[model samples]
Target: MTRVIVAAGGGGDAVAAVMVGAALYGAGEPAVILTYAWDRLLVDPVPGPRGPGDFTGLRPLTPHVLAVPAAAEPVAPAGSTLPRLAAELPHTFALIDPHHGARGIARQVGELVDQLAPESVDLLDVGGDILARGDEPTLKSPLGDALTLAACCRVDAPVRLLVAGPGLDGEIPADVLRDRLGAPVATLAPEHVEALGAVLDWHPSEATAMLAATARGVRGLCEVRGAGLAVPLTDEGPTVHEAGLEEALERNELARAVLDTTGLAEAERHSREICGFSEIDGERRRAARLGARAPAGLDPDAALARLDRFQADARARGITHTTFRRIAEVLGLNGTLRLDLRDLLLARRPEQYEAPLWRVPAEV
Candidate 1:
């Protein structure tokens, strides 16, 4: 029977999903890993869902079914998290194009389901925010998870929704998640922690926070500041919990509202209707404006000057930290090059620059 594992949150979730899959299905179980090209602006310079045109070459597995070639390199310079997964996992990794929105994406997923005829499909979310009712004050980037969840509901395969490291993403608090989750069937032990740690550096933030909290032996009411401010966390044994996909949709008001969305724009509109505001969308607009005016080639001296002004503006707006990725986006630096520049700027942090947002105030 064919089985598939999909990351509810892109980027690091893809890495975390594999860890969960291995634990449940045994190592090297030959499951297709499905993720998206999008990532948080904090993690990638080019934020937001990328279009099919952005990909250099995508082999069509079936009609309306596009899969990333084993060695496909992104057409754009924005560092994509998908390629990393593709490189590490080789032929097993595929990316979903969310540009088509909820209904379009669900159709693609249906095509995949039809081809594989999978006996079961598991949608794995690193954080428990997928369970949020959309009114949570801390909720940001709910569109991706909501869109994926809506699409999952359309699949004929029996689907299982599992959330790991509850509240680690700093969106939904652990206590909140616990109140909703009856109990977890599996807990993240030291071995699982070790396996996760091996690849934790690849995708930082939430994944790193969970690993650190587990290592410190901190549980219940822990705090993580990666996503924003001092977000609460719960040790709760770093467990992975399972829930019926249908029941999960029923509980999430926003998910249910957008389940029938035909496109990305419609999904986004419904998201704003339910959640009130979208920080990810706002940042995307700013990044797009920045990219539009950005020079084709970067001048470090000029770029740093712009960043200095940006820091001042952020401070004026009471923004604590600004990620190097955001700076790269504003400066219009391309993929690997932006990462390279970040390393150099980080090496010169404190002495040359100062910002509360820099993870390491004193060191890179």
Candidate 2:
């Protein structure tokens, strides 16, 4: 049976989805993953959601397509680790454009469904935030998860919502998720945790700590910088909960409204309207406006020089966190500029780079 597993929150969720998909479908089973290129600004510097424009060599199944990399070719724009799974796993990775929003993404999902004819579609959320009601004070990045959830609900195929590593994202607590969705259908095995840890080694993600903790059988409160909160992970470890999509929607009024959203913009607007802030996306835009520009494709020396200057300026202004996207835009660097910026900064001043994707001024 053809199965499509989508990373509901993008970034590490995509990576985690691969492991979960493998566990459910059996190793070597050909499963397709639908994930977005948008990672935490710490992981990717670019602001806003990425589109097909950010990728290379994606075989277009339709005008709006879900693409896997051509062989080992890079699928995402140079910096993102979303498609890095292409090298590790035998499964196909299909990217859904964040720019298209929910309506457009739903269209893409429909197209893929027609072409692949997958018997099951699983929307995999790394954290339990997918169950949030938008009023969760700790919710940082809710738009993407909500949009993907809405899109999956829109699809004709029966979509199962799988939440793994509850409270890991620092949004909704694990207890809240279990209370809402009932007991988990499955818990991650050592093999699954090993696979996730292997992928984390290649691409260091904010989600790594939670997975690592889960794997080691650590429980209780955990601190994830991305979440900005010390959330609780149950002692049970990385368990996977299965809930009917309708049951999930009924639990969260915000999600129900999201289901009615016409597009991504609408979904985002709804979030901002309710929460009174755009969270990380807002921060990215604010930071990018003050971005420093260097040349696109700068050599190592030039890139380091730019980073030095940027850090100096940030220190002068007492700016604690500056993302790669802002740096890339300011530098006027094109194509993998974030990757270049990240590499140079990390190599030259590893101390300046902090958790969750930031080039911090040394002082503060």
Candidate 3:
């Protein structure tokens, strides 16, 4: 099922939203819909009509699905522009705003939940400092109250409470969030700050790249262990030492191809040294003696069958298994190779087979 992620904040929350969205997308999830509550802005048409009109002018950002709400007057005169903007952007996933008062914001969220019931929603409270330290008394603090109400709202999906920056202070504790809201409360990692900044700055590409880099970092940690393969220097030609079996196989292939080629001034000499064969004068002599002998006038199908037998014999003798496993491990396919090998071995002699050695944990 597609989950809806609601991000609430000002310019600062934008980057975090984008980064999260990009990360989710990279993980093969649906694109995140970004919504911002215009909590403190006066729009042009109205003195303070708090709804979704304040952000309508930003319609050009349809590709990113950014929504802005209109302004709420008198009580939230500065933010009236926000609601208006939000009203215009229907494509956004969810609307979020810090509560000036607990009950009112809770009631609003409850109403929104009822309206958007069955659709999963995650609420991210962005720009908390503004609500906590704002000037007006009417702009009291509604974050704590709103969170409480949102937690109690009846829905199949639990409400996600995301607090950004210093705003994390007043929200429910991690334990309480799990127990009461039936949701996990997580802090934005410090590393995500730059990604958040990129989103707010409207640099989607940069934000996406940063998220990708983070994924790669996490994947590297999960895959690599110890001081991995090391390079070496040698007088012969700086040959790579401690190279994995895969590298050795690649080098062997190159050497084989060079020895098999026809025209070369020093072909006979190099071939003798490289292939460990007796001396030969010309290309014809070498082809007749050292080169792989073709089945005399054999059909194409027969030739292919002979080649397959040779390849299978090479594998069955374990000449390629070690290198294959090492390469598979490097490419994150060790588990798959183990499974296939176990299946093959078991099919041959079920009574003698045992469980696979490379058993990745179920959780992983």
Higher-scoring candidate on TM-score, 2 or 3: 2
Instruction: Tell me the deviation in Å of residue 82 in model 1.
Output: 1.1
Model 3 CA deviation exceeding 4 Å by range: 8-15, 20-36, 42-49, 53-120, 126-140, 143-152, 164-197, 201-364
> Model 1, 1-364: lDDT tens per residue?
5567777867667777666765676554666767777755544557576666777667776677666764566674655656555555623666777767667767777887889887668888877878887888878778888878888898766678888877667678777877667567666655544444434433444553453445345433322333324433345636788866777788788788888877767777787888896656786786787567644665678876776775565555445444454566556565455556666675655554222123322222
User: Model 2 TM-score?
Assistant: 0.74
lDDT (0-100) at residue 323 of candidate 3?
20
Per-residue error (Å), model 1, residue 301: 19
Check candidate 2 and list the clashing pairs. 42-357, 45-325, 292-330, 292-331, 293-330, 293-331, 294-331, 296-333
- Cα lDDT tens digits, model 3, 1-364, are 3445544333224334434443333223442343334322112212211333333333322321223423322242233323332333232433333222223333444555554452445444432322221222222223222222232232234554443322122222223222222222332333433333322222212112222233223111111111222111112110111111222223332222332222322333333454343122322353344224432332334433443453344344332211212223332332234234334434543542111111122121
**Order of candidate numbers by lDDT, starting with the best:** 2, 1, 3
What lDDT tens digits, residue by residue, belong to model 2 across residues 171-278? 776667777665777776667656554565335444544654565565444333431234454555477778667766665555666676565666667777776666
lDDT of each: 0.65, 0.66, 0.30
Model 1 sits at a Cα RMSD from the real structure of: 6.2
Candidate 2 Cα misplacement greater than 4 A, ranges: 70-78, 226-228, 260-262, 289-364
Better of 2 and 3 by lDDT: 2
